[model samples]
Target chain A: MNLLRTAREMLEGTSYTLGIAGRTALALPQLWRRRRETTEQCYAASVKLIHVIVLVGAFAGMILSLQTGLALADFGQEGSIGSIVAAAMVREMGPFITAVILAAAVGSALAAELGTMKVSDEITALEVMSIDPVPFLVLPRVVALTIACPLLAIVANVVGIYGGSIVAESLLRVDPLAYRETVYDVLARPAELFPFPKDIYAGLFKATVYGFLIAVIGCSHGLRASNGALGVGEAARTAVRNSIILVLVMNFILTRVMYT
Target chain B: MSTAASDAGAAVRFESVEKQLGGKQILRGLSFEVPRGTSFVIMGPSGSGKSVTLKHIVGILAPDAGRVLVFGREPGQLSRSELASLRSRIGLLFQDGALINWMNLEDNVALPLREVQRLPEREVRPRVAEALERVHLADAAQKMPSEISGGMRKRAALARAIVSRPELLLYDEPDAGLDPATGGSINRLIRRVQRELGATGVIVTHSRSCALTVGDRIGIFEQGRMASEGTAEEMATSSDPRVRIYLGIDGEATTERSDSRGAEHGTGATGR
Candidate 1:
């Protein structure tokens, strides 16, 4: 009986998430009509998240480069650490870490904010005033996330690559110029399977998808929130948890699809 | 009976409306009407579905059966765009004020005018200022909702509700959770705003004082049904034991207890 109930809840949650995504898609035109609102949301989501993205990206890059360099040293291939770090960050880790940061920061904030509004009847008030909550609230957030995620991913890419280079030069005794040259060469090379370099388009695709998913999931939890303050807190926690899990799961899937 | 009178220029009418929420029947064949350009107050005990009834008028909660007519049109039958257009003509002041906490008082009041009505900033500014002034929150215009007193927040919400000068206004527990003086002032504000806009007004409240002060007509809800409805004088003079018990007019405490239970169980009408 417990298992059945859990299964039912999961199904309901998935449908609810899909419903929000569909509504957000339909409300996309409001991004133009309410450009100022969308712009403000975009600025808010991006500005607060940039620092986290850079800090996390740099550390992740350094750790990956140092560990991989040490492992490859046994094989006398430590000089190729730049190629591995650049490829991993660009194709996977950059977007994944950026998404995780955004999920914790922006996605949780969105859920808490909207959940408070829901419990307080502000969303109902909007509807009473003839403002569809989807167009007025969710559309701007979704559009902003979609726009901000890719830009943050780019920032992550730059920071991560630079961090990897610094670690390679300092720890692996690899030449800075040689590491830079190898990273550029590896990222610019065409894939044997795909038309474009695996890193560029694939990383961006993941970032955009992660951004869209975060917004939709956060908004869904928020809109369904009830009970009041405790409920709002729960919604925020759930949004962040779900966002992190989904981002990691999608990262693995996307990497496999793009690379293998 | 209310539905019959509804056609005589009623702004809102509910004919045998039923609603169930969270496995409980909240509005059980409920019926009421608010005549155009008049104030109708529905007073009830806690959990008696006053707010749910208010939601039905705006199409926020559709009736499970029967009809809810707003501006002589069935809200459930309208398309989304059509419903939005319909709602633009109505204003709602929710319980707890429902002001956007992130926005300052002035912007909160200006939102409906700018977003819903699509009014330009030049036009929105003056209207927002005037509404704030009327609510006597002009000094707190730049203050966020959390920065203000509860009474001030309620006033700010009132300002937002009236800023658009809607054709209809709905207030859900407008006087709830306030001291008598603050609740009295909010009630007076509701009356004044309704009169100024000539908007049909429907207020949900538990305060008999609020109902008597603001209602051109009053309905008493009990157990998901409107038990009695009349003008202030008529309701005050009502011989119905449930009405007397609710109004605190019955001197006998034992009778009050029995009547209260009956009202809760929806058996009071038969007992009377």
Candidate 2:
């Protein structure tokens, strides 16, 4: 009987602008704090993630050069290889690759740590102490990831450009100087290189939002998780799955809006 | 004794509280008073709403139909800073210890003092060391929560809770998972801390020993209200069958005892 009434109250709560405003008011500080904490955790989590990005970038650059070199060679347009690879990497590949890396690396960790805390009642302990877990746990990671994602995007660009250069010089037998000039010419336009920063910044913004979303969802779900190891596992899986989907959806929406 | 007077000027009150969740009335028109220096035990059967009662004291759950006061101000009436100030005076010992796995024992214990108190870095170490010593876990300060035993984790939690020298200590089933001997020791710690620090203690526990040892007064919760209230001796000798059953002692006459505690929530034995 009381549950029905409580549900009704919650429903009525959804009907009011004041209720929505109050909910937002209460949630904003928590969201801000969550962003800050997630940023901190993201720093530690991103170290290994950066290593993976480097390894993948190096190999990915090598593979792109090989395929593009072969294709251009067949068309007797081998010298156009550096420009083609540079356009693809700077325009799209760099940010896309970094986003995917963070979703797997830092996203998973946020889920697992928050899940463990939730199952173990650490989050409850915070509530009892009147500490906002959002600031203490979530915000650091958000801030850290926000900063780290852009830095990683920059790193991917450097490695990818170098990979394209290597393919142009070695696989196509083009001179290193010629390949460098072609790459520069292709990237010389402000539209090409200018968009890089926007893309990188947007990628970082997405990552920050992504980190915050994952941490909040993870912590919220975990804190509400049923008691047991299974609950923790479920929370982690859910956080990762949800974050990946959100990241992709956000990336699609944001890229179109920014570029268009 | 000195700080006790200061906190009396800052006591928390709850008036005619009622709370319902999911069609179930967890707390129904419950009212209570907690003064500055007395340890108050909230005793009840599994679903009698003891845990919900504690949540109200901390402002985690706003009462659906009544008022809850901390430092003479309603939790909702106070500004965020004022509420935080009130909260800083109260220390909570969670049932599962709730130690942060990413933090070492020392850092976990030192967290509030650093974040809320904002003590200098040099000053934090000694305060952390002293707090850990109070719980007899000074040497284990560098260990992770997983590295410690369940009992040690509880001790770490105690260290963290008391590190800031809070004026009020709240325990949610402080003795839930321990053996009888260990639970007794925990009870003694509760009493010892309350006595030494002169802090008001509110403990929710089914453990009779814990209540007897630590609480100066006991309040029995039943059917979502304060069913009965008395001293431990009065309760033990009362004619109330519910009180007798709560004491875990069988009585000699025709006493009506409801077995509702075991019916739902599995005795809430270890507490959520």
Candidate 3:
């Protein structure tokens, strides 16, 4: 009986979350009128997220360079570390690292804030005032994150590649100029469809999808919160957990679809 | 209210409205009518579905069975824009004030005017100031909700509710979590707003003091159903045990005194 009830609730929650996403898509037409709130949210979601992305991006690149460069050292080919780091950072690690930071920071914060508002009747207050919470509250958040995540991923890619270049020259005894040329080579290579390389486009596309999912999940869970503080805690926790899981799963699927 | 307004129709009507939450039936065939421009209070114990019924009128929740009509339009059946149009004519004061914590009192009160009416700042400023003045919170307009006391928050929420000059006002436990003195002030504010605006009021409270102080007519609810409803004088004489127990009507003398006291305040079951 408990399992059945749990399954039912899970299905209901998934459908509700999807409905929120669909509503967000439909609300795009109202974006111009609500530009001020969306701009404010953009500041909160993106400007506040830059430091975390930079720190994580740098460390992730340094680790990638050290591990892969040494492994190639056994075959006297550690010189290839530059291309490997650039490709990995652009295709997978850049979007992934940005998503991890965002899921933990912005996503959980959205859930907790909205959950508190739900418990306190603030959302209902908005509704009672004839303001739809979706267009009023959720749209700005979803749009802000969707726009910010991809741009922030570019920040992550640049910083990570530079961090990898430093590790390659200092730790692996590679020349700085040679490392730069190889890194530039990978970035310069073009894909089949677009003028840009597949790595850059794929990473950004992935970030956009991940960002949308995080905001949608966070807002959905928060809006459904009941039972007060405990329920709010659960919403925030679940939003982060679900966001991270979806990011990893989507990373693999997008890689296979775009690359293979 | 004019006789024509009364003859036109009730401001709100609940027809055999039933609702369930999490496997529990919160409202069971609840039925009532709130006359246009009268303060109608539904007094009941906790979990008696007073708040749930208020949400229905707001179109926040639809009844699983039956209907809720606001000014002759069924709220549950209205489309999103239509419901919002209906809701724009009403204002609700929640138990906890429900002020958007991030905004100052001025912006909070100014929200409906700016967001729904899209009024220009030149017009919104004075209207917001007037509402704060009406609630006697004009001095604290710049203060955040967290900076205010509980009573002040309720009053600030009242300012926000009335800034739009809504036609119907709903109060969900307007006196909860306050000392009697503060509660009395809130009760007075509700009566003042209802009378001054010529707006219909549907207040849900378990506080007998509130019911006696603000309600022109009162309904006593039990287990999601109406046990009794009448004016203060009629309720004072009601032999219904549920009404008797809930109102704490001890004897004929006490009931007479309570009714007269209620009348003196110009509201308490005066049947106005």
DockQ of each: 0.76, 0.58, 0.74
Off by over 4 Å in 2: A1-43, A164-178, A191-231, A257-260, B1-13, B250-272
lDDT, candidates in the order shown = 0.83, 0.71, 0.87
Residues B49-109, candidate 2: write the lDDT tens digits: 8888777777777788988766566665566776677789889999988888888999999
Residue-by-residue lDDT tens digits, candidate 1, A1-260: 99999999889988998998998898876678878878898898888778888899999899989999999999999878889999889888888888888898899999999999999999888877877789888998888998899889999998998998899999889988888888988899886777888678889999999999898889889998889899999999999999898888888898788777
- Over B1-272, each residue of candidate 1 has an lDDT whose tens digit, in order, gives 23345446679988998999989999899988888999888887878888888878888789889898987788788888878877877888888889988789999999898888789889999999999887777777999998876777888998998898888988888878887667766776677777777889998877776776677787889989999998766776689887776665533322322222112113211111
Off by over 4 Å in 3: A1-4, B1-7, B63-67, B236-241, B249-272
- Candidate 3 chain A: worst-modelled 10 consecutive residues by lDDT: A194-203
lDDT of 3 by residue, A139-228 (tens): 999999999899889999999999998998898999889888889898889989878877788889999998998999999999999889
Task: Locate the minimum summed-lDDT window of 10 residues in model 2 chain A.
Answer: A13-22
1 versus 2: better DockQ goes to: 1
Pick by DockQ: which candidate is best?
Answer: 1
Instruction: DockQ for candidate 3, please give it.
Output: 0.74
The C-alpha RMSD in Å for every predicted model, in order, reads: 7.3, 7.7, 4.4
- Range of the 10 consecutive residues with the lowest summed lDDT in candidate 3 chain B: B263-272
- The true-versus-predicted C-alpha distance at residue B130 of model 2, in Å, is 2.6
- Candidate 2, A1-260: lDDT as tens digits: 99999899545533432332334335555564355455456567567677788877766776777788888888887787777767666656666677667766766666677768877778877766666665566556545665676677667777987977776777678777877777777776544445544434544555555544444444444444565788777766765676667667877787787678
True contacts kept of each: 0.90, 0.72, 0.93
Chain B TM-score, all predictions listed: 0.86, 0.86, 0.89
